[model samples]
Target: MSAIPVKSKIDRDQLLKISPFKEVIKPTVPHKHADYFELILLEQGGGYHVIDDQRYEVLPPTVYFMKPGQTHCWDFSRIPKGYVILFREELLTRECLDVAYNLPVNITLNDVETLPGLTRQFCDDYRAGASPAILKAYLQLIVLKTGEEARTQSAEGRFTPLYYQFRSLVNEHFHQVRKIQAYANMLHIPAAQLNLICKSASGKTPSMLLNERIVLEAKTLLSNTDLSIKEITDVLDFSDPSNFVKFFKLYTSFTPKQYREMAIARLH
Candidate 1:
């Protein structure tokens, strides 16, 4: 018998054009993507989905979201039928959607059954040749539902605008600003206030979050590129190679060389 193929799909541009009707794939296996977000609704069958470091059982009427850069894999011992939507971050802008991006990163459909009819309606509408404007409207509605569910079910507080601003700044300047005060200065907020906002929203201080984001980027570079640590440090503007090494160790408990070795081992 032929081995089952691991099918991986990624779209980093506009929202993917997808069929709203249920899709069935048999004997599919595990896969991962580097950049893309996926929303999956399972209509039938049993399997498992691994997102990041967590695994979840797959059952009928199940829903899940997978963010970019996270690894996900699914079991296919039994064929599964479902509607899957793939979209990019740019598809929904914070300015356009009023901070929809602040919604929780993941959700389960079973917990939010109050909207199955609405979700089904959306699928039906899309399948029935809905216009792009209609589809976008439906998508925003879905996001709003998810956000409401998250707010009701999650113990974490909603992301404040200050926290959102800090996250955006980190995304834009993580390579350039290594200190919490630098970001606070850029935002014209006191360092202590920034820390308070980040802590209230994400349970981490601004400096910790900033360092963690930088470390994540550094790990990606170390794993995917052939650049030397010195070159990577220069690109990330760490002032010196030694400072970069110290920063990486402080956040990751691994020196640059050790982290690279571990990453190379995993690839092999």
Candidate 2:
């Protein structure tokens, strides 16, 4: 008798590009993927979602945004029926990608109680053979609504749309524009005004936010890719490799090599 070869669990891209939507496979136990983002709409299910080392209960009409590189897992023992849309970052429009990727927004969706009629209609459309493009648009709408609702329900209302926009622009262009003045120019606002808006909304200066974004990308590249430090420095538009090293150490307290070693160790 031949032994059965165990297949690895399906990832987000495979689930989206290969699998049929209506076919319900056996429930996936707690699992994580490193390369894909998942936007899930729970039609009917109760579970625990672990994202970025934080755990929350998942209930009906729940919408979640799981970014790449964040560790996420879910337990569906109690309720096992829902809709999961697995998509890659490239699936998003350029504008959506600019907003969603590399920003500091919280990506977990907790027990979302308010389900709008529009979302219900979207779900119905998804079930009724909607195109992937339509599904992506609906998912983006839900994410935007969730953020808006969160801001309205919060006491401080710290995350304004302009703040989000600035943050998105910073994430998308931090490597090229290392100064607040350049960003202000791009956004068509005075540098002082941009600084005031950032300070009012996030309590951080625009320069600080931009540096943080650049440092984050540097760290990601240092850990995930095989690019040399010089190449990385050039890609990030540093005047010199020494200057890039100085900037990286100033932000992270560790040299590039040290940081990369630590990150790889954690994975092992």
Candidate 3:
């Protein structure tokens, strides 16, 4: 717990920070951003990012939207070249209507050349003490562009609303319910239908998505708190710590103790 930096120190007001990925000096440890939105634009990189339950390859020309309370870890093979645009929802002047933006979604921004100019300008303006209005306009532009990209994926995009709802259900109930069928029942759909919905929208089955969400929450607790394994099992409503260990190892390849140690080492 002393090793993983908890997000208890975040300020109350909405905040925004922009920095080049290569210049960041902090450890890229597995952690949760509990109080703000994260917008990361990648131009060049190859690595793995575990966001929530699913794992994503850190491919170039991609933008990832990470909502508040999501846990993410980056293990880039090389120093990634990109911009990390972080902000709180309060920073924006207008409300964004993209339903998918409320959750985490990674969209491929194909025009790689275009992102650099905006990111560089934003950083420059930020460092030179530019007006809040100008800085926010840049943030809005990136969000709008990413939303357009999400919408361009045909019928797949049409399935986003349902997918988001299902995911939200999983996020909210994952601590207490681990069964995919249970989630389907809550969503008022058959288990098989729910699986198909997730597959169509995310290329991953509902079971995998649900498992990942549970694993993420477990990992967060293990890393950020001083609670013992038994206490964590109780928090997650597991039958016992042994059962919890088995489930954690199934997705993470590390038992709770091992995962916590490794994360603490990296963060330290």
Cα lDDT tens digits for candidate 2, 1-268: 0011122334544524322223332344333444555555565656566554345676655556655444455555465444555556555655555445423323334445444455666767866888877877776665555555444333432545556567767755666767778878878889998888888876788888888767766775665567888888888899999999999999989999998888778656
Clashing residue pairs for model 3: none
Candidate 1 regions off by >4 Å? 1-106, 111-117, 127-137, 147-155, 179-192, 223-227, 260-268
> What's the CA error at residue 43 for candidate 2, in Å?
9.0
Looking at model 3, residue 4 earns an lDDT score of 33
What lDDT is obtained when candidate 1 is compared to the true structure?
A: 0.65
lDDT of 3 by residue, 1-268 (tens): 2223446324666477887776332336666666577778887778777675456887778888887668777777766777788787666533352433443467777676666677878888888988888888888776766766666642343445556668767766777777888888887888898888889877889888888777777877776668899988888788999999999998988999999898678556
Q: Which stretches of candidate 3 lie over 4 Å from their true place?
A: 1-5, 8-11, 23-27, 93-104, 153-216, 219-229, 237-268
Query: Which digits, one per residue and each the tens of the lDDT, describe model 1 over residues 58-115?
Result: 7666666655444455655556765677765555645423335454445556554555
- The alpha-carbon RMSD values of the candidates against the true structure, listed in the order shown, are 6.9, 9.3, 6.6
Better of 1 and 2 by lDDT: 1
TM-scores of the models, in the order given: 0.61, 0.58, 0.60
TM-score of 2: 0.58
Residue 102 lDDT in candidate 2: 29
Tell me the whole-model lDDT of each prediction, alpha carbons only.
Answer: 0.65, 0.61, 0.72
- Candidate with maximal TM-score: 1
